[model samples]
Every structure is written in C-alpha cells, then in structure tokens.
Target: MSDLTRKTAAELSELMASKQASSVEVTQAHLDRIAAVDGSVKAFLHVDTEGALAQAAAVDAKRAAGEELGPLAGVPLALKDVLTQEGVPTTAGSKILEGWKPPYDSTVVKRLKAAGIVILGKTNMDEFAMGSSTENSAYGTTHNPWDLTRIPGGSGGGSSAAISAWEAPLAIGTDTGGSIRQPGAFTGTVGVKPTYGGTSRYGLIALASSLDTPGPCARTTLDAALLHEAIAGWDPMDSTSINQDVPPVVAAARNGDVSGLRIGVVKELGGDGYQPGVEARFHEAVELLTKLGAEVVEVSCPHFEYALPAYYLILPSEASSNLAKFDAMRYGLRVGDDGTNSAETVTGLSREAGFGDEVKRRIILGTHALSSGYYDAYYGQAQKVRTLIARDFIKAYEQVDVLVSPATPTTAFAIGDRINDPIAMYKNDLCTIPSNLAGNAAASFPCGLADEDGLPVGFHVMAPVMRDDLLYTVGAALESALAEKWGGVLMSKAPELVVNR
Candidate 1:
C-alpha cells in the first residue's frame, strides 16, 4: 500500500471516494507530520488545524451525502505566505504584518477551495518575497529536508519544504524570478512557473507585479498539473489574467510525453557559475533526452547574459510601486500608537520596525532607481533590456520546441554563505529570472544527485508564452528517462529524518 503521507492528491481523492480512507484520516496524517517535523524544518508560519479538520469533516459529509465531487476533493494543500487566505493571518513572513488577517482570499485560494482542497496552512516566505533563500524570512529560516542545516530555496521555501518534508501532498507557490522552481530544485520537489498571467493574482500580495506568478509545488509533474488545473482560469478581477481557455491540466498530464519533440539546450545559462556536479547532471539528463529521441541541440539566446542586471532594475522599480499600499494607518501592523501619532508617523514606524534588511535594501534601491532624474537611466533602460531579452527568446523559439538549462547556476548553498553578499544571492537566480521577465512558462525537475555534496540538481525546461503544457511534455519525458537511469526518484536519495511518531 502507498504511504498515506506521500500519496499524491489524486490518489487521496480516489481513496476518499472508494471509502478506503476518510479525509480526516488523510489530512490529520499530514498535520501530524507537520507537528512532528516542523520544529526543525520551520516550514509553516501558521496552520489552521481547527479549520483544516472542520473542512475535512465537510468533505466526509459530502461523501456521506452522495454529492458530486471535484477532482481535488479532500486533498490538503499549503499556501505561500504571500497569497492571502480569508480570516487567516497572512504574514508574508514579515514581522510588520504578523497578526494581520486578510478579509478575503486570493482567487487562487478560492478556486482551490472550490475544488475541495483543504487548506493545510500558510507556508513561510521571504519578507515580501525579496530574497532567493528562506534566510531572508522575517519569521525564520526553513531547513532543507535533504540536509537539515542546509538551505531550502525561496521565497517559496516554506511551500517547497513542506512537500519535501511530507507536511502536505500539494502546495501553492509563487515565482517572481526563481522562487518556486529554485526551491523545488533545492528541496527535491517539482515546481512550475506557469506562463505569466496563467493564474490570477487578485489577492496575492504584490511583489514585482510584472514577474509574480503563482503555481503548484509538488513531488511529481502530474501532481503539479493537477493542482495547477484547479486554480487556472480567466479571472475578471485580474486584468492580466489570460482570457484564453486552458484545457484541463490533469488530462494533459495523464497523456504527457515528448517522444519525438524537439528540445533545444540553451548554450549560455550554465558555465563558470554552475557547480561541477550540476553541470554533470545537466549533461547526463541531455544524453537521456537524446536517447529518448528528442532532437537535442544547442540554441543561443545571447541577450540572456544581461537578464540579471535588467531584472534587478525592473523588479524593484515595479515592487516599489506595488508595495506602497501597506501603510500602517490603512492595513498591516502599526506602531507609534501612543494616541498622539499622526497617520504618517504610525505608517513610517511600523514599516521601519517590521521590514528586514533585505526588504529595506530593495526598497532603497527601488526608490533610488525610480527617482526623478535616475528613472530614465535606470528603470527605463532596464525595460529596453527586458524588450531585448524577450526578443531573444522570441527569435530562438522559431527554431525549437522548448529550451533547456540549469534551473539554478548552483545547487543549494550552505546557510549564511550568501547572507552577507546580496549580489551573490542575486546571482543564484540568474538562469531563472530570464524566463519570468520574458513571460514564458518554465519548470524545474530533478535530474540527478550532485556528486560533490550528494544534493539534487534540477534541469530547467522553458517554453514560449501560453505553452505551459509543453513544459510538462518535455518534463515528463526527461523525468521518466532520468528516474529509470538513476534507478529511483531523487527523494529516495534524501536521508531519512528521524522523528518520533
């Protein structure tokens, strides 16, 4: 029998329908895992245990009533702290908003609930999703399940870690640059960055509005697709939400395969920046794809070299504008409440006290970049660079089906290694930011274990805009081939975390 904790959400739904297990039994199993291992992993910021159990009871009642059920009916899911959940203290891992409960749910949350996916709780994230590692979280750092002291990637680290640690079977995460996919690679799980506007952003706390995208984080591509389908559709509230109809992702995943498709390996992304083991694994995955009849060849998107610099300029410029609404007098944590304070004082004090170093750094950089005289030189020039990068991808797509590269330039680095060096941390997302800026869909799946530290390495697959299904097709082909070649799944290599039941 499959381990209840590790069963995919699809399996849980099937089990619930067959009366083989109750939703309470399954949801509690995941909740129990969180209670057991989360002290060290620190994956969750807040878990709604009563709400979760209550929802589980409702799922049971539905089954008892013989009503029609959704595909994700009874599956438990974790939300990134950046996404708002109704009546839940949605602290985006920032001390400034610690106790602020949102009055409504993000559209993604609404859809997931409609699908009957139980809310396991909110996962930790970088304060305002500013950093590439969970170390930037105002609450606390999340430990990698593979190696407790090592880092799990962020700003989606909590959602990534939860799945890796078996706290939940599925979760929602966002990617502004590499937040979702890098964390997935670091934690040995599957993370997808859907095409820009593929999912609605109605209530997700804005973080670089142009690049932010919410998608699924899970242990397998099929699982990710199942979750992705649950929340993806046209949302009138979000002006950017694509109006084009998306076919059922679950059906696509069930039939996914890339037997004779073309795969272009990006020539520029991985070089001196990559760890030797990561490069080795990348090449190994390529060889397997070639063997599986993918027409693998090197393709160049030369402007990719300038993506990091451009991303830094554009993301903060947009973020500076997007995050302006959280003034203390209006919403979020407040300070200077001696009854003698003006609105401005309370807002200033609250932000000054609550934001972490990284958030403050970006805010400063953004304010400078968007200032009167420097706007054209910095922000405007960066948009020109963004145009060039997008053009580069558009030109290259004319000759290939999808592109490949290392999801990150390196495997997960040790904790505190890049903390003091802001540029070093930014460099980690060099390969990922390009996809976000270009508004294309991408995914990162485990290729193999790195030889040096024995950590997992992820191979990135990128496709043009609105072609998210292409990611799964190529991803499944590579995943199946790599697993067969490696003799097992990457999580099989993860060392067991000893915990008392």
Candidate 2:
C-alpha cells in the first residue's frame, strides 16, 4: 500500500491543494488497495477504476486550469450500494436488484460529484439493509479488517469495512437502526446517523421510510464531518429532507472541546447483558469526558427498553410496504415466468427467488404486522411506543446536552456465531435502536479495544434532532483525549491485514 492510502480525507485534500499529490494518484492508490485486499475484506461489490480515474483526471485538469474547486475536491470515497448512481450497478447486496443499472443519480451522488469527490465504487450491504450482521447480505459477508474471522457489522458493513481496511478514507452509509454506527464500532472507524431527515433520502432505497437515514462514515470525526456537510442540506426532491442549514459539524470536530458540556449516560443502555469489556470502555469514555471538563450524569430513558420491539415492528411494517415495488413486474430479477405462469405467480416466485432468508422473514413479519385485522395490535402499538421513545429523548435533552452509551452490547463476534440465531442477531442493535426510534442524531466512535476479545468497542453519542454538531463536539473531544493518552489513534492497535498481490 502507498503512504497516500494512509492519509485522512482532510490530509489528502490539503495535499492535492498544495500541488503535492494529483487526484489521479490518490484515486488510483485506493483502487489498488481494493484490488490487493478485497478478496479478504470483501468491502466493495464494484470498483469503478475507469470512472474514478476519469473523475480524478477532471479534478487535476481544473486545478491545472487555475479554477476554484470544492474543499474535498480530490478525495476518494466508497459509496454504499443502496444509493442509486446513474449508469452504475447498484444491487443493495440483494439478488432482486442484481446488475440493475439505475437511470438517474441519487441526490447524494449528485452532491458528492458536485464536491469533486471521486467515487471509487459501491460497497456491499445487507440485502435491502435488513439485518444487523453482514451475514445476511446475498452477495457475501464483509469481514472485519481487525480480525478476518469476526463480523464487520451489518447493512452498512461494507462501507465501514472499506474505511477500516484503508481502501478508502471516506464512505457513505445508511442507518435504519444501527447499521452505520454499529459497524463503525466493530471496525474501529467513525459513523454518524444524522437526525432523521437531516440528510436527503430521495435517492436512497427505502428499508424503512420513516427511519432510514443516509450519513457519512470515515476513519476520523473531522473527515465524517466534512462529508456530512458536503452531502447534507435541503433536497426539494425528498419531502422528508430538512430545509435548515447543515449543522457546523466540521467546526465542532475541529474545536474538540467538551468544556462545560453536560453529558448524560443512559441508564437502560448498560450493565447486565453487556460484555464486561464493552462496559469497561463505555465507563472509561464517560470518565474521560468528566475529566475533560464535562459534567456527567446518569439519565433514565424509561421507554428505551421498548425501543427494540417497537423498531422491529415499525421497520418491518414500512419495509414490507416499500419492498412491494420489487414484485418483478417492473425491473429486476423475474422468476417462474416461462410465458405460461400468471402475473401473480411470477411476482410471488420472483420474490421468493430474489430475496434472502432474512429479508423474507422481515417482509413476512411486516406484512403480518400491517394486516388489516392486526395493524392496530402490532404496527399501531409500535408507533405509540415510538412516540414515547421520542418523548424520553425530549425529556433527557432538556436535562443534558447529549446522551451517551455503548454502541453495541458486545464486540464483533465470530461470523457464524449469530448467523443461525435470529434473536441473538436482533439483540446486536439493542443500544442503537432508541436513537432510530426517536429520530435523533447519533454517532459511534471507537473508544478502545475490549480486554476479553481484543476487539474495538464504541462509545455512542445521541443528540436532539438537528443538533447533529453536538455529536462531533463530544466525539472529537473524546477522540482527541484518548488519542493523546495512547499517543495515537485507536486504529493504530488494529492488527495489520496481509495484502496478497
């Protein structure tokens, strides 16, 4: 790997601006990194070498012409496959949309291009972004870069894995529950789930319309903040898009000050069930914040206990409705249509053939939840609980600047450990579900490695809606404090991946 591959997005941007490194050089380095290690990491489903180089060349051309460019002009990024990119194959890690080339660019893609960021290619994800572990992905699972045997986290694992493996400095991810943040924790990277509607959802394939949020993933808080600003803002195309100005996340990340900041530790999110190492890192992170001039207090979000059940019900209900479009009538994989089968039979068979087991399970659960006779008992009650979760956040925010907890109950587990246990897989998102239910801005940053398993542990932060900057303020502060204590970033401790090539 070239030394260029180790540079953060910010450093790369500065190097390109100073005429020390051309965009093509930066882009090609990442492409080569992907080729060298993807067989083991399996982070990307596609690598657009030609397209990325062409984009990089264009940036170089503008620079040679003395034209002004965006702040992140020459940076290379891995895009999650769920977002549509014109003329690019977007499978969303499912057979249903296999080899499907979208006709239009998603809003996020448009913004990223406008910023002059090179799109290396799309990373793999869970089939329709359903499960908490990448094992559910139809294409294949993304292995954790730190340990090849452990999982990299699901739905957006490919995105985080790419960043962790140093194949790309920045990537995009969508968080329905804890997809982005949980994976970031597992991979020793940074992931942010902006407040619901904080980023446009127009181009993102819907898993749960109300809960799905597209956000940034990177190796550092400032890098994630930079991408957040570039891709976030009002989108007339998405009704749920927030019209307000993008939060000052970059500034907050750079500020790295938690002085006088009030931090609340969620009582329901810790103790019993949580692995000892995970709890240890979470408490240490809290103590570090206290020592850094922040006042820390234990805050109770009583309804948070119901977050998992409510999220399961609500997400599937919306997912069942959203995925109905893939009935093989329009575009994508169609099965059992030998010209003799009826349309209904084709739709049924196509879905049966296209969706993976986890996706099928969610669709069935969601359909049952939304059935006319059972809607009120299941989906409707889940909504009521969702409202209470939001209320808990409102009351907590009134007393504290932000909430904190461990991102996941345990560190990355062996790939096959939870593959057969649906209940065990679902529990991975226990600490992350409340943020999704409340529609708040939340993020996960590596706190330290677990003592028992020697895997990365994550310190999670939650902020009120639209107060996305607070996440960076706390994350950057802790990240800086911890880095100084260790004399380097936590990722320095990650076991090196042997790249064959």
Candidate 3:
C-alpha cells in the first residue's frame, strides 16, 4: 500500500499544496486502496473511479494555472449513499432505489465539489438509514476492519469502515440516533454530528427530518474538523438550517487545549448494561481529561433516561411521513406494474418488494403511532419526552461546557449477533439518542481498545447547540493525550487484513 493512503487529510493537503504530490496521485492511491481492501471490508456501495480521477485532474490543472484553491483542495472523500451526487447511483443501502442515479447534486455534495474535494464514490448504509447494525442494509452488512466476523456500526457503517480501512481519508455520514457516532466508535475513527441544522440536510434521504444530521468522518480529530468546516454553514435551501456563522471548529481542533474546561459525565448513560471493558476505557478517558487540567464532574441528565423510548416513537412517526414519497409513482423501483394491476396495488407491491424487514417494521410502528386514535397516547407523549430530553441537555450545558460518555454501550458484536433481536439492536443507540433528541453537537473519537476483546472503544463528547467547536476542542485534547499514552493513534493497533493487493 502507498503511504499516501495513510496520511491524514490535512497532511495530504499540505503535500498537494507544496507540489510534493499531485491530486491525481493522491486520488489514485486511494482508489487503489479501495480496489485492494474494499472487497473484504465491503465499505462502499459504489466507486466513482472515473469521476474522482477527472476531478483530480481538474484540480491539478487549476494548480498548474496558478489559480488559488480551497483549503482542502484535491483531498478525496467517501460520500454516504444517502447524499445525492449528480449522476451517481445512490441506493441508501436499500434495493428500493438500487442503481438510481440522482439527477442533481445535494447541497453538501455541491459544497465539497466547490472546495475541490474529489469524491471517490458512495459508501453503503442501512436501508434508508434505519438500523443499528449495517445488517439491516438490503445489500449486505459492512464487516469491521478489526475483525471481519464482527459488524461495523450501522447505518453509516460503510462510511466509517471506509475511513478505518484507509480507502478514503475523509467520508460523510449522517447521524439519526447514533448512525455516525456508533460506527465511528466501532471502527476507531472520528465521527461528528454537528448541531442538527449546522450542516444542510436538503439532499439527505430523510429517515427522520428533525434528527438527520450530516457531518464529517475521518481518522483524526483535526481531519474531521477540516471536513466539518468545508461542509457546514447556513443554507437557504434547507428551512431548518441555522442562519448563523459556523463555530470556529478548525481553529479549536488545532488549539487542542482542555485546561480549565468543565466536562460533565452524564449519569444516566452508563451502568450494568455497558460492557466492562467499555466502562474501563470510559473511566480512563475521564481520568485522562482530568489529568489534562479539565474539571471533570458527574452531571445527571435525569430526563435522558426517556430518550430511547421517545426517539423510537418520534423517529418512526417522522419516518412514516418522510418515506411516503417512495411510492413507485415518480421514480425509483416500481414493482407489479403488469397490465392486470391497479396503481395502488403496484405501489403496495413495489414497497413490499423493495423495502427490507426493518424498514417495514419502522413504517408499521410509525403508522400506528401516528394513527388517529392512538396519536395522542404514543407520538404526542413521545414529543413531550423529547422536550424533556432537550431541557436535560440545556440544564446540563449550563453547568458544564460539554458532556462526555461512552459512545456505545459495548464494542462491536458479531455480525449476526442481534439481527433477529430488534430490542437488542435498538439498545445500541441509547447513549447517542439524547444528543440527537436535543439537536446539539456531538462526536465520537477513539479512546482505547477494550481489554477483553481488544476492540476499539470510543469516547463521546457533546456541546451546546451551535457550539460544535467545543466537541473538537475536548476531543482533540483527549485524543492527543490518549495517543501519547498508547504510543500512537488508536487505529495503529487495528488487526491487519489479508487482501490481495
């Protein structure tokens, strides 16, 4: 493997700017890596080799002409299939939209292009971003780079897996109840869920409109921050987009000082359910923060206990409404349209054939929750719980600059471990749901490997709404401290994969 594939996005940018390496060389190296390992890792659903090389050539040409380029010019990225990229096939990991090439670019895609980032291709995801493990993907589950028998986190598992496998230095992922952060935890990479509206959601295939947040995924905190600034900011196209300046996240990640910072450990997020190795790593992270001069305190977010139940109800209700657009009328897969079938029957059959079991389950649950007679008892009450969860965050933020916890309750389990057990799969989002419910900024960075399984553990940090920079500030501090103690980045310890290069 070429060393270029191992460099951070920031490092790659520096080399490109200094003419030490051409954009085509960098892009080709990653494409080569994808060709070598992706068959085993199964990270990407599509690979845009031609488009990526063309973009790289354009950047090289512009550099030759002395035209100033964007800060991340010539960097390659792995885009989650949920985001629309003009003319690229976007399935969102479901057969429903299989081979469906989008006609236009999503706002996030446009931004990345304008910044001179070369998109390698679309990464895999859970069908419509629906499940805790990538097992729910209609295509197939993404296997962890650390252990091929285990799962990579879902629904954005493909994105995180790509980064961890070094097929792409940066990737895009959406967090709707832990999709981004959990996968990052399992893969020993960095994932951030910016404040819900901090990044535009116009082109993301909606799972739950209010909770879907597209953000950056990378191997290092600073790399994630660089990608975050590139893709974040107000967008008039998205009604929910925050109309304000993005926080100085890139600067904060570079600063990386946690002295005197007040950090709170959420009391409700961890306990008996958590794996012992995960808890051991979490406590070590807290102690490391304290040693770095952060004032670590245990803060109770009492209402957080209700986050899971509320998220399930609210997510399904919104998903029920959002997914209605895929009725086989306008575009995408259409089934049972023989001359004998009615339009309604075709629509029903198309959905039945296209959607996987988990998607069907959520739609049914959502439909019932939003039904006329049961709406008040289920969905309405869930909304009330959502408000309480937000209030819990608001109160906790008042006392501490940021809150910390284990990103997931446990390390990556076997691929088939919880597929048949929906409740067990749902539990994966327990720690990450509160942040999404509150629409605040949150991130997961590698802490250390669990002693029992030697799987990577993630330390999660969350900040107040629009104060996303705080996530990087704390994450960078902890990441640097942890790396020093471990003798290198946590990813250095990932077990090697045997692939024919």
Which RMSD values do the candidates have, in order?
A: 1.3, 0.9, 0.9
Task: Assess candidate 3 and give its TM-score to the true structure.
Answer: 0.99
Clashes of each: 0, 0, 0
Local accuracy of candidate 2 as per-residue lDDT tens digits, 1-501: 349999999999999999999999999899989999999999999999999999999999999999999989989999999999999999999999998999999999999999999999999888888887788888889999999998999889999999999999999999999999999999999999999999999889999999999999999999999999999999999998888999899999999799999999999998889999999999999999999999999999999999999998999999999999998988999999898999999999999999999999999999999999999999999999999999999999999999999999999999999888998999999988999988899999999999998999999999999999999999999999999999999888888889879
Model 3 scores what on Cα lDDT?
0.94
- Candidate 1's residue-wise lDDT over 260-357, tens digit each? 77889888987887899999999988888888777887899889999999999998888878777778766777889889998888888888998889
Residue 35 CA error for candidate 1 (Å)? 0.9
Backbone clash pairs for candidate 3 read none
TM-score of 2: 0.99
Model 2 regions lying over 4 Å from their true place: none
After superposition, candidate 3 runs with Cα above 4 Å error: none
* Candidate 1 lDDT trough over 10 residues, lowest sum: 247-256
Residue 134 error for model 2, in Å? 1.0
- Cα-based lDDT at residue 423, candidate 3: 91
